[model samples]
Target: MLGALAQAVERLPPARRWLVGLSGGLDSVVLLHGLAQLGGRVGSPGLRAVHVHHGLHARADAWAQHCQVLCDALEVPLDVVRVDARPHRGQSPEAAARHARYQALADQMAPGDALLTAHHRRDQAETLLLQLLRGAGPAGLSAMPRWQPHGSGWHGRPLLDMDRPMLEAHARENGLVWVEDDSNGDLGLDRNLLRHEVMPRLRQRWPSLDTTLARAAGLQAEAQELLAERAREDLQTLRGEAAGTLSIPAIRALRRPRQRNALREWWREKGLPAPNQNRLEALLQQIRDVGPDSGLLVTWPGAEVRGYRDSLHAMAPLPLLDPASVWSWDGIRDLALPELGITLSAQEMLRLHGLEPALLEPPLTVRLRRGGETCRLRGQTRILKKLFQEAGIPPWERDRIPLIHAGDRLAVVWGLWCCDLPAGAGRR
Candidate 1:
């Protein structure tokens, strides 16, 4: 296992840090130990262990403490993260918990860091069975990848080829004690039910059930990759506009399965959640019926699909806007809004002020337009609404455009106007 771990680390992109997800379970404990033992030979960049406390069960804190102690004994740095795993209405508790756990793990990883997990062959088999029960297609049945990008770094399941019994045996051989997660036995969870009930029965009939299922999962993964390649080609034909948005006309021309396939591929590329069968069908129906003037919005738990002017746009669910609330900005210096990654600076404004006949002669204030506004441009005073239309700006962008005002009067209409400047000024 240590030798395999070394090889996996070598295969990863050059990294200065490795974060081990230590759950204090047998699998994670063995994984952490194996990595620690391999460290001297493999020459790691750095090592740290992360333990997430979901706080769902009474033993959660104890598990985190155990992980911290184990990390200390292994001479590895440890971080304990507390996460809220409470499920929302109509959401599965297991899914919510997994989401919280992964999100917490992601938060701890920096760029160039690799996160290692202890998922193995048996776990993959269970995942495959669970996906099958849910009627998932090949992609879902493909189980977990050995390595993938997570947050600012990468996550890998190095022991994915090893079985759970092997990890347990390793822990026992090394005198490692681990916490037993009570939730693992809960029959309410689909994976738990499959593992505790269905898997045992299958193993009784065929002792190599885990191996057989893992092989099947590998085949499914290969098929999924081929399908994904085809979907990418379909996307190239159907996608339109600068936003990487999909064209409804082009998608509609494709067969229904191909349309859904292409859309799912697009969603995966955009990092948005893929829609289920019902949602995809509904989206197709809406796109077919709606005209250019009408907007179609379909929202799932974490993502949304919107249609505008024969184009389809998929995105993570955006916060609802409160029309009454407004953000204020001063025009004197560069300002970065951390929430939006938007920067507003006066470099251009100052350059304009330096020009002959001064393009922006200001005591300027930057703000969102609140309607009933007017501005003067090129020897004529016009309604702001009309100016936006003449400038070919979209309606959604009107409120977001930073309007530069001088005291009570609207001055320059950023990137669109140099009001009050002479006709021959040649603004910067």
Candidate 2:
């Protein structure tokens, strides 16, 4: 195990920092010990251990103290991160703890640091089976990747290829002690039930069940990579004017499976979860049924997809904007519209659209556009609604855009349009 870990760690980029998530479990304990044995190696990455205190178990403090003692003996710095693991409505306690735990670990990591975990072949097998039971696609079935970007840095599981028995053997040979979480045998948790009950029975019938499952996971991961590569190719061909959005026509032209794959990749790149089956169906239905003048948005937990005119947009769930809310702003100063999820500032305008300082009108009030607003563009006065429609601006965005009034005269539309101000600042 030590030899394998050494080779694995050395294969990583040298002269970077690394931190191990020390849970004080047998797996993590063995991981830390092996890394300690490789003391000051070329790719050691200034080793450190961090213990996350989920505050769920009664023995949580004891586990943290044990981690500290081990780190002290190993002569490595330790950080104990305490987090509230209270489950949200309809969420499992186990999942909530896990979410809080990773966020805490992410907070401790710097840009170039890698957070190491002790997930092994058995864990990979278990993860694959769980995902399979949930009827997951290739992406989910490709479980427990060897490495992935975690928070600001990266996450690596160097022991993923090693067996659980190897880690146990190394721990016993080194006389290492670890805290056994009493909840390990709790059948209420699906993973625990599989580990304690289901796995043993399967292993009895097929002695190499874990190994076979792990190999299947590897194959799925390779297949997933190919799918991602194809998605990338399709995206390049279908790229839109904006970042992280797709040309709707190009997407519609592809076969259904390609459409789904491209959309999943697009959402993933935008840092949003892939839409579930129902949401994806809803999204496809919208695209197919949308009229020439219609705009539609389909949303699911943590993500949304919207189509307007020629483009399809995927992003994190947008904030609920109340069109009734209005704000007074001096065009010279920055205006932060928290409820609308936008900051109307001089720099943003200047950097993005070259808003001249000469247009810095004092006492310029900002408000959401109500119906019946009018502005003269070019020569004739045009209704704001008609103008937005003519410009092909999506209906959902119209009310959220800030309208700038230069002392009761409608002067500039924050993002969409600008009238010629007295200072000639809005001409561009």
Candidate 3:
């Protein structure tokens, strides 16, 4: 088992720091102990462990303490991250907790760091089964990869190919102790139900059940790679004027399966959740009949896909920014616009014409468009709507753009345009 672990660790790309996701469970305890034994072989900056305190179970605090004790014994650094694991609308408790745990881990990671988790063959098999039950596609059936780039760094499962019994045997040999999560016995949970009841019965019929399912997942991963490659090639030609947007007509030119594949890949690239079959089909249907002037929007869960002009845009649901809302900003300090999910940097104002040091004596006002606003740009008096149309900014995005006003005169439009401001406009 130690040899297998060493080989797996060596196979991963070298990282400056390695953070172990120690859950105080048998699997993670074994992983931490094994890696500690290898010493200096894990990462250049040495090994550290992180325990996510999900606060879901009653014994959550106890679990964190157990992890700290083990880390102290191993003489490795440990960090316990507390997170809100409460489920949001349409999200399962298990999924919410998992998301929160990973998000907390991601927040601490730096570039060139790698997070190691003790996900073994059985876990991979269970994941495959769960995805299968959800009627997922190749990407979902791929389960977890052994190594993949994650937030600011990378995520690795070094002991992924190892089985549960092997880890249990190692724990016994080393006299290692781990805390048992009482939640594991809750058959109400899908994974727990599979682990305790379904798996045992299935193993009776096929002794190599875990290995076989893991192998199937590996094959699906390979197929997903090919599909993703095809999608990338398709997207190269289907790209819209914007970087991440897709051309509507170009997408319609592809066959149905290829279109679905391309759309899924596009969503993946944008870090948005892949829409389910029904949603994807609905989006595709909209794309087929969508006119250049159509305001077609297809939404699911955390994301929305909209067709505007000749492009298809996928983004997180736009925030509700009341047009009446206004902000005051000093020219020298960076201004954060939480409602718009952006920061207006002090340096960005340098691009605005005629806004010299003398003009900034009075503070600037920022507001969203309420429509019927007009501004003179390059000596031409144009309506804000016409300027937005000329700029190719979609109607959905126009309302979100921060319109900077020098007194009552529109001076800038965030990244879009720097309007012509009259001399001493704000000081008027």
Q: What's model 3's overall lDDT?
A: 0.88
**Candidate 3 structure quality by residue, lDDT tens digits, 314-398:** 9998877789999988776788998888887665565554344235535588899999988887888889999899888889889
lDDT of 2 by residue, 8-114 (tens): 87665543678999999999999998998987654476889999999888999999999999999999899999999999987789888998989999999888899
Q: In angstroms, how far off is 205's CA in candidate 2? A: 1.0
**Selected candidate, larger TM-score, 2 vs 3:** 3
Per-model TM-score, in order, reads 0.85, 0.90, 0.93
Report clashes for each candidate as comma-separated counts: 0, 0, 0
Total backbone collisions, model 3 = 0
Stretches off by above 4 angstroms in model 2 are 13-15, 41-43, 330-333, 346-363, 420-428
The alpha-carbon lDDT assigned to residue 90 of candidate 3 equals 92
Cα miss at 209, model 1 (Å)? 1.4
Error of 1 at 317 (Å): 2.8
Between candidates 1 and 3, the TM-score winner: 3
The most accurate candidate by lDDT is: 3
Candidate 2's TM-score: 0.90
Q: How accurate is candidate 2 locally (lDDT)?
A: 0.84
The full ranking of all candidates by lDDT, starting with the best, is 3, 2, 1
